[model samples]
Target: MATVGDQLLNPESGWQRIDDANKNIIYNGNWISATGDPNTYAGTAHYFTLSGATTNSIEFYFYGTKLRIIDMYWSNRVNNVTVELDGVISSYNPNNSTNKYRVIVFERLNLQYGFHKVKLTTTSTSNNFSLDAIDIDSNGEITAPPLSKFLISSEDKHYSITNEYKDNAIPAMTSNTSPNGIVDASSFYTTFYPWKAFDRIIDPNGWVTNINVLTGWLSYEFDSPKTISAYSVQAGTTPVGRSPKNWTFEGWNGVSWIVLDNKSNQSAFAGSEYRLYTFDNKVAYKKYRINVTANQGAGDFLAIGDLGMYELDKYISSVDTSEVSFIKHGMDKGMVIDLEDEFIERRSVVKENSPLGLGKVFKQKIDTVKTPIKKASIT
Candidate 1:
């Protein structure tokens, strides 16, 4: 039996360890383990403590005739391998989702007999609340699957020109993904599957698929950035009947919301009906979630037709804030930031090295695709 973290056994849970000593303080998601040394939840994205998955995520299952649910979308997600009741991959979703990503729900998702993998190709600058482990509910207890064998499989270098309107790379799958076109370039104006958008010829967003509701604030998660003068958003139609609102003129000020002068809270369409919406300037974000506060619909009926973001970052000023994150962890004993200008000129990236221990935790790889950053190799 795998022992869970002390923090997860909060006062709310039914099960608790009677003999284990509560020795560590769980603040900012880290503290000393029974081992005594400070332990950070610095395992893989979405994955919890390196020892196991319970602390950081939920598990759903039962043997023979059992069901399971997997909670998801933390950071730098590589893959989602839904196992069949017999243990083969029934479906998959990979290195996707936006930065403010929360959870990805899989339903009636039957699984089979074997372990699975969620290999990530990209990484995020931070991690979020993973999970307390999977929840299982069955008349008879089901055995958990074996530890999944996973590895970061490299892919062939694929090349492709930028899209007609954007500079996004629609590279073909080397090994990690499938379909050069499906995963590559797309738009209502262009391509289609494995190499396409979530909803292509399938009538824009998969209104016929899983989603069923939309609430609270509305959001749109894009794969790339965009450049524009102004954006226009519309909800339901002229009257708020069975949909959201058809009001436009809402705006964003680089960071958060910039309340515009236009105000049209049309609840006529807020009663109960499906609606389609669009934007004129096409404002963008990686993920767009509209928090529903009422029973507008039993569940989320968001008929998402697209995903996009601002064309350009335009936030390049000076004094990268990331330099601040490094300051908190403690830097090289004699290293000084005053000479940062002479060290890296064009582009520099640092990766974690000692993923398990505290000794040294970084290595780096840089590419001068655009700017030329200088680098140094310590003797």
Candidate 2:
């Protein structure tokens, strides 16, 4: 959308003007540096970020009066940074004055797509931290006039589609029918998009394999609480590798698991750990999922996990709108920033261009702020 006041007044080509006053990407930039400098906390400021190129979202606004949201920090990729705002994206600390003017907003931090380097650090050492403008909103990923043609699908083990399809996208893969795997509501897959919902009737003993899986089924039904108090199966393990991940709400409520979580065995490879599920509350079974596909056998760490149902008052609607968060940003399509809306703005002032009529050519100028005749008790 690229227009939030021209991306908050366009500045951050990758922002790295760390005028080191001593340990101050955080709090000391409040005052102090005219010449009596003293803000050094290992000063090695940074910048340079191609990394996932911004569709992950970043917003900006800064005024600076008392400015002290715990000094400052939107820091990136290391430990990431989220002082415990609990929205879960990364790196945010609003515990001082809540940064009224020194406005600092944070957003989803799903990196690891391409080049990586992002920096806005500070321990706040006081160089009089002055930065009033900065904006970088990227969905960046379309390089050149390259791909004229690139076909795929095979004839060996499973798939073989060929003609990779793309002529403005055949009205979303079909004009009157086939949506490929389905995603209606006019958002015709809006470039392959789908909200989380899959049901295999709650992974019986566990299963996934429908020839690599495109997608299907998603059901819901509940009501057995007049006699059942607990049952669990809260799986949400995106563990990270690829393909739909998030759904770790394991089951079993005869005793433990007010929520019970498990990453589900996602092939297990790199740093693999949490994958578990033991809480079988005698199997109350209703419905649940998270088997994106692929189980021909043997290790599979590509990653994916979803399937949750915790009933009470519907148990907060079964806590899991499918926590799906993503943004490829290249093939097009995006706009999602809601972890308390970590600063995302769009729109650029383009509505004042309607005055061109020698003889009423496409006209629409009526209201002149004239609404006065309300003569009921006025006489």
Candidate 3:
């Protein structure tokens, strides 16, 4: 008899709460935090409030089987709330004639047990919206996985980028570029150097290209070869039009840059908005970069608040057993076996039997040789 709103009625076990002000949640647009009645809201403190706006949204990622959004239902509140769970869209209206607190605005149950991303947006243009808290099922303890180490972090010496803007004429406020190629862009605007994109801070004054720079490139060099399967890009504080609209994700494979993922005509980003893109990639490389070919009609410049590249856990999909062979003893006939698994990469020449004839044999390079070799009898 589990209830959605107000866990007091039928408290469900293993369901933990995530407050509105949690650092893991990303709030876009003008979201204000205000104090609310302890009895009315789930928590005793503050809740997020938004008034009279559309295109405003909030995103949260959780690892659980069920999710509950604790909001409010009132006359002035938002009439339409659009929920996007792992890219699937749904909508609900929380507008009611009477005030109702601790209401369950949206909930998804029995979801595939894994990590999920949910985005709640205000679809109604001219109404208010409130987010009290969020609840998710837990196994041992309710703990969201911490942000993984990025292959393009500013703290690590192993990670690096191209270069930063260096022009005395422009007079930068502070240059955070590194000589070891930590951060750099094709072009930058004064204080808005390229390093800010990898700084992990979502601010308006992030990495910005020069005005009228329609195309730009940002590259990263790793200390060792890294296999990246996913990446994320966050928009700056304002002017979403400055975001890159079309781009190609490339990796350097000792010779030339190979395109890992290509995107075209992407949707415009919201202020401080974040987006994650994943692709199929197995090869590891020491260098990776992004080549931006177009921007979202930002004839002035392009901007990026943050950039993160991630290497996911690798798993063996299939095993190759064709190269493996088994030799049985006590047989009437002797077989000449040159197992590739045992004799490869030795860097030495090995003399093995050949099917050409008894007088003829072939030589191959292998690391180890079978001791006490005997002549094979060919019938």
Q: Best to worst by TM-score, what's the order?
A: 3, 2, 1
For candidate 1, the TM-score is: 0.19
Residues 1-379, candidate 1, lDDT per residue (tens digit)?
Answer: 1111112222122112111121121112332223231221112123323332322222333322222233344345434433343334344342345432212233222222122222111122233323212322222233333221111111322111111122322232322144322222211221212122222222333221123334333333334443332222222222222233322323444576533223233222221222222223434432223322332233433332222222322111111113222322222221212212212222223353223222333434445477564433221
- Name the TM-score of candidate 3: 0.42
lDDT of 3 at 124: 73
TM-scores for candidates 1 onward, in order: 0.19, 0.21, 0.42
| lDDT (Cα, 0-100) at 184 in candidate 2 | 20
Weakest 10 consecutive residues, lDDT, candidate 2? 314-323
Q: Which of candidates 1 and 2 is the stronger one according to TM-score?
A: 2
Please list the residue runs of candidate 3 whose C-alpha ends up more than 4 Å from where it truly belongs after superposition.
1-93, 96-181, 315-379
List the global CA lDDT of all models: 0.27, 0.25, 0.61
Top TM-score model? 3
Residue 336, candidate 1: Cα error in Å is: 72
Question: Model 1, 207: alpha-carbon shift in Å?
Answer: 25
Off by over 4 Å in 1: 1-61, 64-66, 80-84, 99-104, 109-132, 138-379
Backbone atom clashes (below 3 Å) for every candidate: 67, 44, 5
